[model samples]
Target: MSIEYGEAQLLPGEKIAITTDTATEPFWKKAKERKLTACRCASCGHFRMPPTPYCPECQSREMSWPDLPGTATVFSFAICTRSPYSGEPLIYVPVVVDLDGAPGARLVSNLIGIKAEDVEIGMKVTVDWNPIQDDWLLPIFRPV
Candidate 1:
């Protein structure tokens, strides 16, 4: 079965590569296991999204991948009505979620399981994994 994002259907063979980097490999690896992981700096103890080899805050070269609760609040969002790829009118809510317990970390993901018009700032949400491929997983969000 293919993954469905509202009116858009993502087939098996249509899956794209999530990432190909040594530094960010752990993030994708944990996602495949249905777990959310973020890099926490060993120096200043700050969480960094789009995981990097060095900490942006403290410039620390040491980092660790910590398991996240996957619970968040919608800091901001936008309802996209036009498909950038196909140019067909579609509906999708893209949200920036402020990770719970991770003060400085925010993840950009899509909101599902609800209508676009229903999404609002500060709405509680939880992560939902879409297993598009055997090794790749997409982290979507749904209202909690």
Candidate 2:
């Protein structure tokens, strides 16, 4: 699958709605507590992001969520001049980061606290919360 995005030039004003369900509620729930978590296969210990209903490695519906270190490496990123959701002119860095403690698990989040030109692969970062609609927090990253 191909995901297309761009390098964001400046930080955008965040005001979007988020919805969750059985497979992803735990993630949002933990974010409310200021914790980072990833889904793990209860039977195999394999970690996955965007929490799936079934494990690809073991096909087990059973899952466990383990708290992460709130640290990650930038696997890929983009600096864009437009908001992905609203299509208005804005600046934000969209990034795919490899979770520090969860092998093979990566999160798609925005990067802040650093300039767009300076962002690079293998950059170390830590999580920061973005308060959005419904009292939920979105996980964004910043240089560590």
Which pairs of residues collide in candidate 2? 6-79, 7-78, 7-79, 7-80, 8-79, 8-80, 10-91
Question: Judged by TM-score, which candidate is best?
Answer: 2
C-alpha lDDT of all candidate models, in order = 0.78, 0.86
- What number of backbone clashes does candidate 2 have, counting pairs of residues 3 or more apart or in separate chains? 7
Query: Which candidate leads the pack in lDDT?
Result: 2
How displaced is residue 6 in candidate 2, in Å? 15
Off by over 4 Å in 2: 1-14, 85-88
TM-scores, each model vs. reference: 0.84, 0.88
How well is each residue in 8-48 modelled by candidate 1, as lDDT tens digits?
22223234446458788888888888888788898899998
Candidate 1, residue 7: how far the Cα is off, in Å: 9.0
